[model samples]
Target: MNRKQPIFYLCSDALGDTAEMVVKATMQQFAVDEVNIKRYHYIQTEEEIYALILDAQENGGIVAYTLVEPNLREVMKRSAIEHDVQAIDIIGPLMQAYIDTFNDSPKEMPGLQYELDAKYYNRIEAIDFAVKYDDGKNIGGLLAADIVLVGVSRTSKTPLSIYLAHKGIKVANLPLIPGIAPPSEIFTLQNTLIVGLTMDPNHLLKVRTERLKVIGLPNTTSYTEYEPVKSELNYGNMIMKQLMCPVINVSNKSIEEAAVEILGLMNKK
Candidate 1:
C-alpha cells in the first residue's frame, strides 16, 4: 500500500489569499513535495465549517484558516476538536496580540489589503505608462512624465523606471547614444525632472563585455571597447550639462539607493 499525500484545508470568509500565502511560505521550510492544498473561500455558515471539518477528518488533513467572525471561528474550533482534526488559526493569534499590546481592535474585515483604491489604480496606470514609454519608445511621454531618465545603455534605466512606477510615479527613459540626437521634445520640458545616469568607464566596459558574452556577441565589438565606452560616457556627460539635470553615478550604487536619491529630488521639486 502506498502512503497518501497529506492535505491542507485553507478556509476563509473571503478570497483566502492570506492563508494561502502563509501556507506557501511554511511549505518552503519543509522538505516534502506533493502536499495537496485545497482552498475553501467565502465560507460563512456553521454548516459549511462542519462540512469542511468532516472532510479534513476523513482525509486526515490539517485545516489552516483565517476566519474573522467569532461565531464561525468558534464553530470551526469546536468541530475540529470533536472530529479529531488538527486546525491552525492563521490570523487569530496576531489579532489577539494587537489587542493585548495596543489595546486596539481590528475592523475584522477580510481582503481589506486587496481593496482597489485610488493608489492602486494610480500604480497600475503608472506601470502601464512605464511600459508604453520605455526606452524612448514614445517621445510624447517626456512632457507628461513625473521624472525623465537620460543615460547611456546598461545604466539600469528600465528597471529603475519600473520600480518608480510601482510607487505611482510615471517615468520615461531615453538612451543617450553617441551622435544620435535626442528627440526635440526633451528640450521643451518645464515641469518634468530629468535625471542623468552615468557610470565609471571601467565598470561600464566590464558590464558591456559581460552583456556581449551573454548575447553571443564578440568582445572586440565597439560596444565593449574602452575607447567607445569612454566616448559614449563623454557624449552623455555633455548632454547632461546641456540639460543641467542632476546626475547620478551608478557605478557603486544599487537600484534602491539610486531610487532613494531620485525620490528625494522629486520631493524637493
Candidate 2:
C-alpha cells in the first residue's frame, strides 16, 4: 500500500512562524514528499486548542505548537493526549530551561519576536539605503552611510554591503576602476567607516573569466586579461593608501566571514 502524505498542524498564539520553521526544518531531515503544513494562528481559548487537536487526530497529522500562554499549552497537551495525537512543544522546553538556568520568568507574550519596532524599521531602511546607493549610484550616500565600501570589480563589495545592511548598517559601495577617480565626497566623510576590498589578481582574473563565459562574452576583453587586472589592483591599492582606511583581501573569504571581520572593525572604530 502507498503511504499517506505526512501532515503537520502548526498551532500558535501569534503568527505560526516559529512552529512552521521548526516543522519545515524537521521535514528536511526525512525523505518525505507531498508533506502538508497547516498553520492555525492566534489560538486563544481551550476550545480552540481542542478543536485543533481533534483536527490533527482526524487527519493523522502531528501538531507542532509555539503557544506562549501556559493555560493554552496545557489545553493543547491534554487534548492531544486524550485524542491520541502527537504534539510537539516548539518553545516550551526552551523557555523552561531558561527559567530554570537563569532563575527568570518569560514575558509570555505572543508575536514579540515579530514586533515591528525601531530595530526592524531601521533594518528595512538600511536595506533600502543599500539598494539606492549601490555601486556608487549616488556619491552623496557616502556622508549618510554607516559604512562605505570601496573596491575594484568582483571584490565582493556589493554582497558585503547587502549583508551588512541586513544587520541594520547602512552601507554604500563604490567600484574602484583603473582610470576613474572616486567621488570627492568619499574623501570628506565624517564618522563613517570606509573599508577597502581587494582580491589576488590571479584569482580575480579567474573569476572575471568565468563571469565572461557565464554572460556569453569573450574572454579576450581587458576585463579578463592579466595585465589590466594587475593594473586595476595596483590602482585600487593606491587609492586605499590615500584613503588610509583598513583594507580587506577577499581572496579566500566568504561573504559571512568578510561581514564578521567588517563588523569587528566597526566595533573597534
Each candidate structure's TM-score, on Cα atoms with residue i matched to residue i, is 0.66, 0.73
Query: How accurate locally, in lDDT, is each candidate?
Result: 0.91, 0.91
Predict model 2's lDDT versus the native. 0.91
Give Cα distance to truth, residue 89, candidate 2, Å.
4.6
Candidate 1 accuracy as lDDT: 0.91
For residues 26-138, what per-residue lDDT tens digits would candidate 1 score against the true structure? 98898778668999998988999999999998898889999988888999999999999999999999999989999997887777766899999999999999999999998
Query: For candidate 2, lDDT tens digit of each residue in 142-235?
Result: 8789999999999989889999999999999999987789988888887999999999999999888888889998778888789888999999
Give the Cα error of residue 155 in candidate 2, in Å. 1.8
In model 1, what lDDT does residue 44 have? 82
Q: On a 0 to 100 scale, what is the lDDT of residue 148 in model 2?
A: 96
Candidate 2: regions farther than 4 A off: 1-65, 71-90, 101-103, 209-220
